[model samples]
Target chain A: MLLVLAVGPSGPSSRSEGVLVRDNNRSHNVRVTDQVQSSKVPVTVLTGFLGSGKTTLLNRILNEEHGMRIAVIENEFGEIGIDDALVIDAQEEIFEMNNGCICCTVRGDLIRILGNLMSRRDRFDRIVIETTGLADPAPVAQTFFVDERVRDELDLDAIVTLVDARHIVWHLDDERPEEVENEAIEQLAFADRIVLNKTDLVSADELEHVVQRIRSINALAEILPATYADVDLVEILDVGAFDLGRVLETDPMFLEDLDHQHDQSVTSVGLEIAGEVDEGRLNRWMSWLLANQGVDIFRMKGILAMEGVSDRVVFQGVHMLLDVETDRPWGAGEERINRLVFIGRNLDREALREQFSSCLVEAV
Target chain B: MSGLHVARIACRAEPLAELGDRIASVAWASDGSALAAGSLSGQVVISDPTDGAVIELAAHELGALTVAWSPDRRLASGGQDGIVRIVDRTGEALAEHKGSGWCESLAWAPGGGGCLGAAVGAQVILWHDGGQLETHDAPSTVASVAWSVDGRRLGAAAYGGILWFERGRAAPVSAFEWKGSLLALSVSPSGKLVAVGTQEGSVRVHRLWTGDDLEMSGYTGRITELAWNSSGDVLSVGDADSVTSWTFRGRGPAGSRPDVLGGHGGRVLSLACAPSGRGAERIITGCADGRLRLYSGTDRSAPLAEIDVGAAVASLAWSPTGDSVAFGDAEGRLWLAEVAP
Candidate 1:
């Protein structure tokens, strides 16, 4: 049973002025604004525990006609047998394969694969990746933010997780739940939309309980119920989850609070960028962080206002794989500011903030 | 001094066939008659250096991560599947060496000897012809490996720094620690100096016997590759976006800061210095922007010639006679260009 839950606005906006106006949902409006006129290809990450239905959903998406060309990066646990099995349809743009999980071992493979996909820029309209069950989504997501080649060609849309409803309670209660729960919960914890599958066996009360539990873990993610892995195609793709405009309009405190409670074993800190950042100073600070606190820092990202560059330089890292790139120019009437977030375990936010702040070049 | 003298030389050549994959490792045959390239698709292709004709050797079950060519031109390649394979002259797998970790880099010892070295995960393995393999503890995850000119020592660059192990020794003779991770290392042809390139874009030169160090700075990206000239006076360093040459002043009393030779557009991935006694020797470089270029020692500000490879040039090597150059690209395409002086 394959399931896909894509959620976003239907059809192109009729607004001729190029800006969609909305009062109640500023977050959604912001996303639409950033996406306007920008043919940013949506990036969807398919994540699940081993055999939790990730590849099943991936196959379904490949077979369907979404009116856009899609590229699928199937990250297998070992050898990449999925690429040979994929029967290509002329309607789809391109289908690529990245065998092995997206971790330290295969990070270089990810960069090369993404670079190759971008070389044929006109062949695909969007990209979809099915991560190995044990793979961490943060590094994969950070790829889009870090590599200049990837950033120039692709825009991350959303991180989608397929939850095994039947095994959820049991998996979470294991003695060393951190092992299974870390990847699973991190998947859901960072999800823009989660597909809670295999729910037909559970009672309505039990399903509600599971939903509540997911909410307790991640308040930002939208939860959708799945029976035998059936989900709407329109509900899971192009969710505009990573739309920067939407990210800015939403209560900044959303990520701040979620960063704190997402994992008792992990924490995230957000820093404000008020001035130009010296590249040398930032390098020293990052070196110190990676050298001293790398074990605790699982992930870090920042939209920096550099000293010379007019656009915001975005940087992200997962463990040792750090990537930095220049993003879209600050639009007319947009404020030039910097914001960085660090996600990890037992990090001293004040110390990090102080170090990062000291890296700022003061106005002479 | 003000403009940082540089020039862009464009090559008029067609692009290599698209392998639809990323290139992982490349090597040039000792005779310079052929080039071998490997990609993430688990395909190895040997090609004619001039016309780019390919002979595919589909041996590995998984992606090949590194390749080395013996002095006699026998090919030894390591793959992500933890297998080291020796390919015959016909590019057929003749022997297999198995290990527990991913084999990342390979280096053939100088001379047509039976020994070959590989940086496999966190350890260095030396494989001899009699089926005996010796292992030495690498300081960190080994990213690159090189053999001393005499084959009596092996140098490996890893996470924290560079480690040199003398043959038959259980521990490293010396270890040099640095701030950032070491990305690549090259031992001088004369066996006098070891050049180490780090992730912070700094190139450090060490006097092999004395452990003295000289660090070069100013690059904003990671140093990707390094090569030492046969005379041991000049060093070629490639980084994420450019390539430069460094010349040492003297052996000891008059030792001075190394002079910089610069020319390259993208991050240089591979470099090779022409053999000694070749007047005004040329340094060949491969870059991310898909170019294979040559620069003369006399005029470091400009490239003598630039050939467009149409894929990221992953590795470069100079022929023994210095009459031709060999390079491999990301798509596992190899090219040999006949140089006219």
Candidate 2:
């Protein structure tokens, strides 16, 4: 039997008003933002472990008369096929950069396939890439950050990881050969939203265990439990999960609500403070931290309150590639605060909090 | 001083025929009598440059990714549907073969026995006289393939590197190791050197039959537009906006400066070197800014001539005779230009 789950969009707002602040290379800002208009296609990456029901969700997305032409790029040829969707098969080809930058690997196949799809842009409204079970989701996410052509033409909407609630613990604890990674843990750590499927098979207490395990690794992801992948279309499609403008919509209590921990090495660290940060000090700290320990940092996102700046500085990163942008101005009477989250392995929570506090405005 | 100068040589471009869909690949016939263009909407057309005539064929229902001319005068086209077809100039299908996935790369061997090499998915299929000559599975999906000048060896570029194979061999005879993805591959006319445009914004050149390899990095973006001059002494590379030519002489391109041809306002999408034996060597660059610029390979600062093509150029080819050039654009237009001293 196949099972799937769904995630819903937090809220809808005009995503067009955000200003992207590209720090690594200033020139990319001019060209990337120039084409960020409505014509830019949104791509959703769906990843899960084996028996996680990604294909079932894909079939639902294609068969529905949603009035959008969707192109589905599947890593494996599933057992069932749908008639209407423009399905393209992809081989999982991970490409490492020659520059020797750690964690800079990307999915080379997506770069080639996406280039071909962009040529017939009129034939499809959006694209969905369903990664194979046991695939590392980081390379798929990093493709958006590394390739110039893909970065300019397509917007990475979100990474939705489907979880097999009944059998996830077994896979999570499976021992691997020394250098190989546990893909299940990495999937959860990199996810923007996670679908906890097969809820019906587990009791309330068992379901709670699975949810706690997921939250231990990724506290920011919205976990939606379902059966047979019966996810609402609106919640999963075009969520703008990567848009810096949506950073304000996150729940303020998620950072403080993490009360449990898992034995697995991967975990989440959240920092919430009520003060503005010194711009120069924050830049220095962020660059230094990412350069030194970016290999273990799977994903990070934060909405910072900069000193003397009225707008919120929002940033999100996959490994070392970070994209920062200034979001909407703070609403009148809104208390200024900073919220940040880091999901990865071997994170020292106290050290991060201390370093982050040092960058805060010093008791004015 | 801006250190940039503009020079004008006698050159003019005109629309030859429009295919009504985005042209994916363009190639000139071996005799320079016709031009073949494949469109993303699955339309293939053979056009006469001298006259405004066209013969259109529904070659690939899904879309055509590549088109090349066999030395025996047949036009071979491959498409997203994983089918390869060979057709005559009159638009009649002479032969057809099906592969596993999207057939993106096609190259006809130079010795003229009607041999063709194609990269279809992760497998390399060699076709001769309407039959499969040999097939070899690559380590990963094959991105590009090329044939040696003597037609004795074929090089297939994938994730690992270029795998060299001889005819009728089930396994690769040798390989060049590059631990990155190769986007484009080119074998020199002398058949002694191989060059590949990598996914990491660099050009890697390997000396055939030897382990000598060199890398040229620091390009503005991934190096996809690559070309080898007729004599194989020059390799022209294109990235985000500018084109650079590296001369492979003496001990090769090591420790030498490249001549930067900087003028395009957008990414250089295509590059083609003029045929050899001509009096002067020239290379043409088609850019995303909808312009074509021609430059003498030896010059660093200026283009010989340029014209606005009104769309992002997708494919470019210099005719065998070396006096004319044909380029296709994103707007499904095939253009022919006359290049003169």
Best by DockQ: 2
**Top TM-score model:** 2
Q: Tens digits of per-residue lDDT for model 1 on B54-76?
A: 67775455467777788888888
Per-residue CA lDDT of candidate 2, range A237-288, in tens? 8788888678637674666667645434888888888898886677667767
- The fraction of reference interface contacts (C-alpha pairs within 8 A across chains A and B) present in each candidate is 0.00, 0.23
| Candidate that scores best on lDDT | 2
- Clash pairs detected, candidate 2: A4-A229
User: What fraction of the reference structure's interface contacts does model 1 contain?
Assistant: 0.00
Per-residue lDDT for B11-119 in model 2, tens only?
A: 3344677776678899988889888999887888889888868888766866788999887678999988888888888888888888787888999998667788999
Each model's TM-score?
0.67, 0.87
